[model samples]
Target: MRVAILGVGLIGGSVGLAARQRLGAFVTGHDPDPEAMRVGLDVGALDAAGTLAEAVADADVAVVGAPVGRIPEVVEAVLRHAGPDTIVTDVGSAKGAIVAAVDDRRFVGGHPLAGAETAGVRHAREDLFAGAPWYLTPRSGSSGVVFERLTRFLAGLGARPQAIEAATHDRLMASISHVPHVIANVLVAQAAVVLADDGTLPATGPSFRDATRVAGANTTMWTDIYLANRDALVDRLDDVVHRLQTVRADLVAGDAAAIAGWNDAARADREALLAVGLAGGTAPSCELRVAVPNRPGVVADVALALGHAGINIHDMTLSPSDDERTGEVALWVDADGASRAAELVAGLGLRVEGAP
Candidate 1:
């Protein structure tokens, strides 16, 4: 299989890495930035491609990993160069516009619910989408064969592919992803107003830090996302405002019972939603821990090695010692593949700490 990745940044590079290292696909990358293209090659994510046309000329699949604002244009260009049977998809966060713009049978709108706070190719990891939800938004005219093929390919990359409509997907993302980002920025802005003069921001607790972590995100990328999905975001923001106003009224009236009830209901609802999301389409997995030196790219190396061996890691957590010289990585894999995964890690000169 041949895969062409456009805009070889974090998501694009990760797709290339996974396609090559896991699926044994011939990956080619096209990026406007030369440095990003170089990083993709250095990380074994993709081979060299002189231009976008060259990258997708004979490709079986072309993944448009450009930012939300540029996705429509890039997808159009990809469709122009892609083979008639080639499946074209995008990893843009906002999907409605892209889906509307591309009226091709082989085009499938997709958004991988996996990323890091950091951007750029330097931070790309092949395991970024492992056990993550990769949403597919196929229109009525979309080819069923293309959808099935893409789903199977995503599953091979360890991603859980879920089918959803474009409008519903946009609204859900607005509520879950975009609104939280806006709230984070607002919370941090309010905090700055209070702390600017006193310089006592250092006293903020972990709760505050965690809540505001997404504030001041990649400005260029987020600006594009906000504008593209402005309508849905505004609707969700209004709902949040209404809820806040209701809470304020309760507080002003000293209605303690109402406030308590609201909090309890919210907690219950959140727990239920989490349970449902976790339980759906979940497979049994075995957890294995491996002790290794605490160093850069150790996790990436372990993940790539496992991918090369066709062992998909469902999830992973790294626990570093206080001295930072050693750490243990707890990796979860399919129950059937656990034994082989252990052997693969052990072969890497890392100690397998416990039974799988």
Candidate 2:
């Protein structure tokens, strides 16, 4: 399978790397930045493509990993260049607008819930999507075959695929991802004002740091994201403001019981939500133990070997033997990919010690 990546930044590069390294796909990448394209090739993300048109031409799948603002345009271009059977998907955070714009059976809206504060192809890693939630929003008239194919492909990348409607995905993301980023910015702004005089924030705890971690995100990217999902984000922001108003009123009235009740309820709900997330993310996987010499780059060699064979390692741990001469590496892969994983690992002359 040949895969074309529109933008060779972090997410795009990671997708290319995983497709080539873990899915055995011929990956091609195109980016406006020549440096990014060079870095992508150097890191083994993909082969070079002269242009977007060339990248998508004859490709089985084209992933539009451009910024949120440019996604629709890029998707359109991909569609123009892509084969009729080529399945096109986007990694944009805001999906409603893109999904509505692309009226094609082969187009699927996807958002991989995995990233770091850092950006660019230089920072891309093949494991970025491992065990992460990848939301897919299929268009109204999307083909079932395309949807299933995309879902299975995402699973092969070790991402947990969840299907959701575009509108619902936007609203949920507004609450979970977008709004939190806004709140973080707000909190840090307020802190900056308070600390202006002394230029210090003493006695700040982990909670404060955690809350303000995403205070200043990528301005260009976030500006587009905020504007694209303005309506849903505004609705969620209003809800947050209303909740804050309620808390203020309770505090003014000295309603200790009310405050305590609200806190308890919120704590329980948060716990329940986390529990559900844990269970949903833990897919059935197979574990294989392999004996290896305790040496530098041994693990890397094993990983690269599997990568060359298109087998993804979901997780791994190493334990040394009594003499410290050899260690057992416990590797995990999705149950469906286990047989291939074991076969690939065993071909490296290591003793595979588990049924998986």
Candidate 3:
């Protein structure tokens, strides 16, 4: 099936790469930036870059990986052009606005929790989505075929499929991804003022570097996440403010126990979540695992192999590695049905490994 990706930036370029590896799906992208298009074509991230209509025409999936702000318009345009059975998706950070703009039953609001500090197609890499969670928010009365295809599509890309309602997705993102992006920007602004006060600023260590690394992402991109999820962001922002005030008050009081308590609680909560996340079996669908052949199509090969096995995959994630030949595929399937799936996959002559 052909897949069209509009925007052709990092996200759109990534969708192309994933389609290649997961489904061997024909991949095309659209972007006004000729240089970005050139980069995608040069790097082989896209089969071709063309006008929006051409990109989506007869495509099985039309994905809009544009900026959060531009997503609504881009998605609506794709909705108008999509084939009758085309599954349309957008990788916008904020959901409320875009979902409302394009409420067609064929549409699914997707936000893959993955990205690097870089922007543009030149930075596009097939490894970007390894082990990431690709969320899907289906509109009511939507065609299940599109959702099923997307689930497999995301699985083929080595990402876990997380189904969420649009409203819930927006609220969750405000607390996790969107709000953090805004806070990163605000913190960077604060750091700038502090740096200006001194001739030399202290080198930000790993913690600060990690915290603010995303702050350097395109401001125009972030502005959209903040605005589209404004209501939820505001709620999350208030909670953040309260926590900040409490921390400040504790510091002012010189209460070591209070500070320690805050740190201890945070560590406990985070560690607990990590423990569960670690067990997601490295793939979105637990039923199938894709063995990526270090160089490319690692994801697609795995998905197709599993599909051929007729295994009902729940979620999947692939292990990250620098060696293109040593990719690890993790499949999530029932313990009772796992051996058959594993044996069939191992027959492919790929080193098939699983959590069970």
Candidate 4:
């Protein structure tokens, strides 16, 4: 497979490196900054660097890694120059706007939940996305062939690919990721104001340090992200403010029981949320074989169904019949969910059975 990375920044460079080193793909890159392109090539993240059109001319997949603000325009250019069969995706955190902007069936909105505190092409690593959740936002009308190809490629790169609606992805990110960043920034600003009068800041404990870790990260990139998902972010922010007001009321009333309950509730909520990722960790792993007919959107429909039902696919492989009229998809999932996964696949009018 040939992959083209449209921006050779940290995420784009990592994607290139993973594609080349892991999948042995011919990875070409194009960056608005020539220095990023040069460094990307020097770091072995790319086989070559050139103009956007040249890079994507023959690519099987083209990933737009530009900043969130520029993704729409870059994706438009990528689609215009890429081959008709080339699948186009992006690593932008916000997917709703980008997906709506691109009306083509070949385009799939994606955001990998992987990154490093350090930035730039030089810091890119092939294993950055290993064991990470890579969300793919594909509409119902999106091409199943493109979605399947992208899913297989991402899996090869050691990333877990899951299908979700663009709007749902945006809302989840707004609540979990964006709102935390905002809180971090606000905490730092408030601390600065409180310390200004003393003319010297006191040492902070881990609580303060950890809470403000993402405080002022990549201002330019984050500005675009905040604005891109403004509506969702605003709604979440309002919820945060209302919750804070309740806390303030409890403190003002000196309600120790309410305070304890609030603190314990936070701990419980955190554990519950984290458990979602660790659900099948202790369970034995198994595979389910699904017999499906060769058709457009069939793979995507089944994949999305299982994903929406909260079944995690650890690995997958597709085997087509000699006549290409039928195929079987082998899905590796935790033993605890294998039976349910088979049930879901079977409900889709496909033949599904567990691998004994």
Candidate 5:
């Protein structure tokens, strides 16, 4: 079980740590950056470090976690060193580019949808992929032994395996990942707080945190993700724009039903979606949507306040105000967290409600 990781950044670094958890798996990392390799070795994440040639030469499984665009080059670089029995896989966010370039014997594209807002080797955590879905895009009826070996490796790391087509993976990620990121990044960019005069951005509370958390993720990684999955993202982006236009029309026309329907669906998602991390618990206490002062460190202050009151917030999201003075925050913790959060914020000599 000697594993060779091509890039030891966030995803690759986490893979190394997770693999090390397995009793017999020996993980080795290969990164072009000398500092990255040094950190991997210093932390004992890799059994050894090597160049492009040495990393995959005798490796049992080659897990490529480089950027989506770099995946092709990384896979190709390692392929030259791959042995006949080696199982080659990748954890790139997008699949089409890598899948198309892979003409090797035992190539499989896998995306483990587990990561954080943070990146780099220091952010690597062993439980990063625990219970996360690892999408496997193996061509139909590939070597059974290769897949078995791959799945055995995944199971050892505590991930659930899902078999899907490469095209399907591309499309799903385009909508689920790229589209949301595009919207969030654009919204954050266009917001007025970004152009504030005092060099002070609007106070960003929880909703802002939820909405813009991924905004700070690797820009190059996201750029590669968008380009690799552009077609599907383009299609879905058009649909989303149309949907927003429809909603805008309804709002302008003062259509009650349309507004209610939108609110209802959003409420449903906010209350439900337990399959996800936040929204899946019991019925919510209050559909609490508030406009909080947009400023730095708003989310933590609010969370601390709620914690003091023993109020449990369920799910929350923030949309920073276009204007520097105000921001909107929506939280759906538990009843207690909500009450305490509000009370604590008020106690801090800050207004609990910015507008409503």
Candidate 6:
């Protein structure tokens, strides 16, 4: 397979490396940065580096790793130069705006929740996305062929790929990611003001250190992310402020019991959220093969059905019959969820082969 990587920075370089080393794909890379292009080729992340048009002209898949603010434009350019069958995806953190801007069947908006504090092509590693949840935000008009290709490619990179709505992805990211960055910055500012006049400031514990770890991260990227998801981030911030006010009220009222209960609730909530990611890690995975006819949205239909039913598809692939009139979609999911997942796929009016 020929893979084109636009913007050979950390994520793009990693994609090139994984595609070359893991998938044995001929990877061509494009980057405006001369140093990135040189290092990407030197580190074997890319077989070749050239102009944007030359990189994507004949690519089977083009992965755009441009900055969040430049993703839509980059994607547009890729589509203009790429083959009609070329599948395009992006690694921008914010998805809603980009998905809206690029209304093409071949474009699938994606965000891989994987990165390091260190940046640049020099720091890119082939295993950076291993085991990370790579979210795909497919449009209503997204081609199932392209979507399946992208998902399989991501899985090949050793990343867990899942489908999600663009709006939902943005909102959830605001709560889980964007807001935390804002809070971290706020914590640092608050701490800086507390010991402004004191020659020796109070020593900080691990809690403070941990909370402010991402206090001032990648200002250029974060600025674009904050503005892109402005409405959702603002909503979450308002909710946080309201909760803080309630805590203040409890302290003023001397409601010791309420304060303790609040702390306990926070602990339980954190555990519950973390458990979602930890669940079924060691569970045996079962494969269910479904016979599907050659169709545009067949793969997407079954994928979305299973996704909506909360069945996490660990892996998937499509095998076409000799005549190409029919195919089989083999899906792997946790053993515990296999029955329900098969039932969901069967409900889509397709025969779930090998289902008990």
- Candidate of highest lDDT: 4
lDDT tens digits, residue span 115-151, model 1: 9988888888989988787877777655545755777
- lDDT per residue for candidate 3 within 1-356, as digits (tens), equals 78898988887888788788767888888887888878998987899888989888889888888778888888888888887788888888777777777767678778888888788888888878777777666655454445557777877787766666678778888887877777888889998998899867887889887888778567777776677789998998999999999999999999999999999999999999787656554433334444546543334444444443434456555565685446555667656557777786677676655535
lDDT of each residue in 247-296, candidate 5, tens digit only: 99999999999999998998898666543444322334564555566444
The parts of candidate 6 lying over 4 Å away from their true place are: 291-298, 308-310, 319-327, 346-356
lDDT of 6 at 243: 98
lDDT of each: 0.83, 0.83, 0.74, 0.89, 0.72, 0.88
Predicted structure 6, TM vs. truth: 0.93
Candidate 4 C-alpha lDDT tens digits along 157-236: 88888877788788899998999999999999999998897788889999999999999999998999999999889989
Which regions of candidate 4 fall more than 4 Å away from where they truly are? 279-284, 292-296, 318-328, 347-350
Query: Which 10-residue window in model 1 sums to the lowest lDDT?
Result: 304-313
**What's model 2's lDDT at 223?**
98
Q: Which scores greater on lDDT, model 2 or model 3?
A: 2
TM-score of each: 0.79, 0.79, 0.76, 0.93, 0.73, 0.93
Q: What is the model-wide C-alpha lDDT for candidate 2?
A: 0.83
lDDT of 5 at 60: 90
Superposed model 1: Cα runs more than 4 Å off: 197-202, 283-356
Tens digits of per-residue lDDT for model 2, 196-314: 97888788899999999998899999999999999899999999999999999999999999999999999999999887666554457788888887655455556545544435455
For model 2 the TM-score comes to 0.79
lDDT assessment of candidate 5: 0.72
